[model samples]
Target: MTGTIHNRETFLSQIASSLGRSRLSSGVTDPEWKHRPQDQVLQDATPDELVDILKTQCLKIHTSLVITDAKKLPETLHEVVANYGGGPIVTWKDERFSKWGLEPLMKKEWPSQKLEVYEWDHTKGAENIRQAEKANVGITISEMTLAESGTVVLFSDKDKGRTVSFLPATYIALVPKSTIVPRITQAARKLRELHHSGKQVASCVNFITGPSNSADIELNLVVGVHGPVKATYIVIDDL
Candidate 1:
C-alpha cells in the first residue's frame, strides 16, 4: 500500500511538472534577470527634484514623507526625516527592513518617537493595521521601483503587513537604485524568478505609482480613494 501511494504521488508530480504547475525546485537565480538594462533601474534622481515631482504628480501631501534610498538608506533617511514633523510611529517590513539594519537607525533617528516594527508572522494580529490607518506616515522597503512612472512595488507577506503601506495617509518608500526597473516587462521577469525560487509571494503585491488620484467625477480630481493621499519614493544609491 505504501509503495502504491508513493508511485501515485510520483506520477502526479510528473504530470504537474509537465503542465508547469509544480513548485519551484530551484532556488532564487535566473540569468535572464541579470541581462536587464541598468538604465531602466531607478535611482536618487535628485532628491530635491523628487520633492517637486511629487507635488505635480501627487494629489495631496497629507501623508507627506521623506523616503531613504535603498543603498544609502542610512545616509538619506537620517537627513531627510529630520525636516518633516516628528512622526508618531515608524513601520517596516520584516525581512528586508530588518536585514537592512533599520532598528539601530530608527533608534538613532526617531529616539523620542514611538517606534513600532512588526515581523510578517500573519499571527501578529491587526494592531499594526489599525495604527497604520491613523498614522501620519508609513514607511517600508520596496521590492522594485519604477523610475518611468515613479512607482514602488510593495510585496506584503507575513511580516510586512499590506496595511502598513496602503492604509496610511502618507506613504514613503525606500527603493534601491538597482531594483529600479525601466518597464513592467522587466518587473515581470524578476517576478517570475522570484516565483520560481519557491518563495511565498505575498497575498497582495501592490504597485503604487505616486499617490492615489482619480479624475472620475467629471474632471474633478480626487485623491486617496483606495490608498494613500500622499506618496514619496526615496531612491538610494547601491550600498
Candidate 2:
C-alpha cells in the first residue's frame, strides 16, 4: 500500500519557523565524501562468487543454506520440510510457488504425504495469524536476497502476511538466484528505483537473517525470543 505522511509540509514548516529559517527545498547540495568503501566491497564479484559469499555469511548467522537447480527444487524443498519435522506448514499466497514448479507439492504431493498446509488469505484476516502460530514451518519466496548479509527480503502485501515469517517455529525462504544482490546498498537502490518509477512499495519490508536470537537475558544467547527458532534458505540456482 502507498503511505502518505499527514501534515508533513506543515510539520516541517513549524520546525523551520521555530528555528527562524525558511524551508530549504531547493539550492541544497549533497556533500562529497572522502571515501565510498561500501561501493568497493564485492564490486566486481560474479554471481557464483556472490553465492559463495552468501553461503559463508549463512554459516555465521546460524542459517542453513541449500543450493539446487530448478529441476531438483521440488525434491530439495520436500527434504527441507521433512527435515524440519514434517510440518503443519503455512506459506504466502504467492504465485511464484506455482511458477517455480511447486504447485504439485503444495496441492497434491503434500496432501498425499499427510502434511497439513495453509496459505495466507487476505480475506481471512486474523485467522491467518492463528494458522501461522499453529504451523511448524512457514515458507515464502524472497523478493531480494542479500548475499553479503545472507538476508532474505520479503515484501508483505495482501497475499503475503507478515506473520508467515514471524509466528512460525521454523522459517524457510525460497531464494531465487536472479534476485541475489551484493548487499543492502543494492537492495535500497532497487527500492528507490521502484519509488521513482511510481510503483507501489510494500508497507512492510522484512530483512530477515536467520532465526531470531537475543543476548538480553544475562548476556547469554537465547534463540526464538521473538520469532522462529530455526531458519533456512533454499537458493534456486536456475529459477
Checking candidate 2 for backbone clashes, the offending pairs are none
User: What is candidate 1's lDDT per residue for 1-239, written digit by digit as tens?
Assistant: 23334576678788889998975566877456655465445344554454445434433333343445455565565444444443544476455664665665545344554534333335657766667767666778778865455667888766678777777666677776567655566677788887899876676888877777788889887877777666666665563
Per-model TM values vs. the true structure = 0.63, 0.91
- How much is the lDDT of residue 195 in candidate 1? 89
Candidate number achieving the greatest lDDT relative to the actual structure: 2
Which regions of candidate 2 deviate over 4 angstroms? 1-10, 25-28, 32-34
Error of 1 at 6 (Å): 22
Residue pairs in steric clash, candidate 1?
A: 41-180, 42-180, 63-170, 69-236, 119-159, 120-158, 120-159, 121-158
Score each candidate by Cα lDDT.
0.62, 0.90
The window of 10 residues in a row where model 1 has the poorest summed lDDT is 55-64
